[model samples]
Target: MRNDVVRLGRLSGERSGDMMHFLSSMRADRYIAGADILVDIAHVLMLDRQKINDRATTRQLLPALLRLHDKGIPEEVFDDRFEDVHAGIESLLIESLGVEAGGRMHMGRSRNDEVVTCIRIRLREDLIAQMTALLKVREVLLTLSENHTESTMPGFTHLQHAQPTTLAHHLLAYEQAFSRDFDRLKEAYARVNQSPLGAAAFASTGYPIDREFTATLLGFDGLVTNTMDAVATRDFALETLADLTIMMANASRLCEELIFWSTSFVKFVIFDDAFCSTSSIMPQKKNPDTAEIMRAKSGSVFGAFSGALVTVKGLPMSYNRDLQELTPNIWRGMDDAGESLRLLADMLASASFDTKRMSEEAGKGFSTATELADSLVRSCGIPFRTAHNIVGRAVQKGDLSLATLEKAAGEVGGGISLAGKGLTQKDIDRMLEVRYSLELRKAPGGPAPEAVIAALGERRKQHHHDAELTRKKQAKLAKAKEHLIAEARRLVA
Candidate 1:
């Protein structure tokens, strides 16, 4: 049995070493160690203010905690022999100040409330990091879109060319999807920022602790209000995991497209050498390995979310050990999604697009057939269904010539006359041209160059607005931390 486990003294028996290791959360607790220390300090300051603990006790405990906060949790604090980081820190304090003052440090709070509070603090920081990373990706998308508004490409439905569009338009589609993801994460942050510190093991503490004061000191927006709900629920973590999973799902889709675009057959994009790898045996292979790995790893993130959901599903409330299994999943999910976003942003910024090949491909695969039908509707005064039938028949005949259109018109146009309809060969040729096809569809959100450019301008404004919002959020957190540490120092002095 470890000395610290014996020192804990809640259980009287000699605990098995294997049991100690099995129940230990030291590895995952490292993530929250710093937050845990800040939480301790906040709780201590609150205790001192409420006169629950003497000023001498606060004087000794706050400095020890402030020193730990300054230098960081030591390597010894992560020793599995300690069962968890909370026990390890408490053991250190008991050793330093003797049990009288050190034991009193946990007066108004339980490890139940403390752990969740630390998780929220750390999770909010990570959420901001993810939001910032997502913004960088959005920035990259906007910059790429600005450059490629006129770079034509064949847009597909069912993997068949359906229309002529620009690379900018396709990239902006992803930007719009990811923009929703950012909004969700930002919304999740609001719920995650609430405090659970004074809940005290699922019920409010008897000590006259000021929950609001502790929440402010720890930079939380407010209390969780219901003490049992505070300790009992992990819906906040589940919500965050859901947000990350959705973002990663979007990322995987973009990666799938990038993988396809980088293929030798498609040749629409060439990723930078840094993001690609050559096959060891096949000398000619420059694989889209980064994108492929990102695509695969998205599954792991999804699995983490699934595992978290199942872990929380069957457990009776009020803080089960099963909840311990969920924290590592949140950490892993956030790390995977955040790293993927950062790498994707870098990969895209370094990539080169085959604009000429895209333009040439845009003109193939009967891509402008829709425009031909629209022209027939406009110039010949035919119903759209009749126009659609004429184009479909002409496409089946494998040509867009006047003879083919005239023949198809007789079969499918239902007596709609083509004679003196002003439908000349020049009109047919113009309708079949990719650039002319693109230009004619100038409605808002169309694939036309002008429409794409206008959309890009609006997206840039939105990005700037989001970026400013992120900056303000970051500044607020920073200011809170500074104030927290300064106040702790004041109490110590």
Candidate 2:
């Protein structure tokens, strides 16, 4: 029975069921199962359009395909006897409609062109979803930035407090990084949106096929052009995983910071209880397990990108069975990235900052020292390097008070007179204040409250622009899908 379905009596060889199952990709089969059905529908529709198949066969074919779509592919569609879902689906089609009608579906395409087109169709939607998730995260960041325009915190370098910056400023930095990620996915979307249908087994079909018509119905932007490259190329899959890795890397950095900020020693921020987990033994432990897991996912995504690149790197291509191994990487990587964005956005939207702790820590490491030096450069005639030396000595000497700073400044000579070349006590008091420290910054991109507010306005504009861009593409795809279904249903009606 199995050999009759899998191979004709014309071939004498038979494989053990164990070997068939071992070589089977049933686990990976479901990812493209729906894609296979859609590809078949589009190809059948195209064949009918080009007069390659009679109207009666197509009329029966379209409604039958839609019924299968409605009921969903059966569990037996993953049966190992067919080797993969593509063959399994064809067997199901043949079973449902019999040989004459079912056999015509494979006339002008191969599993090669069909699978690539399916991957593209599914991946296009996933990328849009990923961007949409990121946009939500970006909105959360913008809201956080707005609420904390003057909320001062210690900004760090090499894990040491380096300067005073607002929580708004720090969050905005991530907002911008993720904006670039949003942009990269948009860019990759353009390339991944092309169709590979009609590239039958690395050669153009002799049949008068309408590649563009199939592309339009499948929601693809255009065709993959060259018949050989269309089916053989895995770069689109590779490009998407690589793009996802970069996005995850950025998320991991934010997650790592959240882990540090939530630590008892820092106490700069606290995760929402829902996003945190308690230790198995320690009842008081509110660990940032969510962030840690997402952070670890960054490495896993990177591995996926690397694994795929190596798989396709040396293959002498038109198409190879080895390409089947690459599909799981794309599917798994996309799943990892999409979930990470959704969870990270949720985790951040409810997070709270310890303003007093952040403010207090902002001053402990002489973070306001730069503002003081800048004051010397402005209020006094001393050169910046001399002012730098004077302030550096004051920081090192632990003479952080108004009175002591005067004495320290007088003692640390750069051969420049301190009598008139440094700030007064009044100036010192203002410069030493963290809020005042933030207010003194007037540079366009500086961490000052007004500057952050201005930057926030600009980012909100960008957020709006990107959201519109996403909506436009989404509308295009939605229309294409509706058009495809409408056309198929039209023929049968």
Candidate 3:
């Protein structure tokens, strides 16, 4: 605490070491240091426009703040000697510009609203990066899907083969999952972009400050509206973490599949030597370390997300020190999810699926019985349950060969239904094949080669549109930052 400040005049400068350490915020505040300076610039500019301070003071403080922004605050500005960046910046300014000229910058704001404002500003950028990272992962997934449109693979349920699906169709599932996550981040950014700068410690300040002007200067979507809610609520923070958790969960699902695919028991996909690591002791051992670590990171993100929720669950209607604890989780969730997603894209780009092995596995586990049952219904006008029962009985006998199916159908009179028709054993043989099963089901979103190709075309279009949107959002931020700097320089001029 500054001994000269009127609010702390009752106390001496000799603060207890442990108490100062407990109250210190400079460590976490470093992440938002730039944001803190920007907040000061916006607020000082607003004060100058509103004439809240004498013209000379506002004029002097604006240039000083701009200078600090251009040439960053001294290291002492972020040193642990201060309680937080707010105090540290103020201390640095008072040291350089004298108290009367520099101190007026805080005339219309409090540290409570100021810190939250900085967090919102910085969090918005992080969320945009998160959205952008998801877009990159989406690109990788779509590329994998497009490349493998005709690549057959065993689609599993309960860890057993249930059907034959193309790799394209399977990869497209995660593309869609991650695409929703990208949308979630986009939505969260809207809330995070609202400005909290002028809320002034849960109430409006008496100073004739222009909240809208400050918001525009800061490139915020708009003011946060309610004074109390602006500083009190951390919902935007919580919502961002929720989006991150969902994204990580989606990535973890892919990681789990990658881990299984790289296993010796599966061998459905092979990782690049870079992505797989050899065991130290084992003569022949390859581990999917990237996938394993990526999968575990989702759990860590969840833990941080839950910790954030618990921290904010029962707080009163205002800022608290507890909110400080929530800030690190935002970085944790974003960093973990963002890096994990990038790693997933890289790991997948260099990986290749075992086309022949996947096809062979697709043939095992009676994967074609469903197709035979459907064929009987379509060609012989047999009810599906009856066909299913016949196939089930035959499957009990042995592998579903054409002879086996023919004898079983005859035993159940499906052959009788088909005997007079033009259907032949050749036709039945074609229907029972795994590739034929996939090729025949050309329904929308099916694993059929044609359907997957069409779906890939559509996903690629969506990905292109989304990627452009992400770029535009980043450009918007850059433009806002540029405008802010230009406006600051003009004010100081």
The C-alpha TM-scores of every prediction are 0.98, 0.95, 0.94
Q: lDDT tens string, model 3, 211-319?
A: 9998888888888899999999999999999888988888899999989988888898999989878888996988899999999999999988999999999999888
Ranking by lDDT: 1, 2, 3
RMSD of 2: 1.9
lDDT of 2 by residue, 363-421 (tens): 76888888888877887767887778788877888765655656666777544555554
lDDT of each prediction vs. the true structure? 0.90, 0.86, 0.84
Off by over 4 Å in 2: 1-12, 400-412
Better of 2 and 3 by lDDT: 2
For all predictions, the C-alpha RMSD in Å is: 1.4, 1.9, 2.3
Name the top TM-score candidate: 1
For candidate 3, what is the TM-score? 0.94
Which pairs clash in model 3? none
Clashes of each: 0, 0, 0
Q: In model 3, where do residues sit more than 4 Å from their true spots?
A: 1-7, 402-424
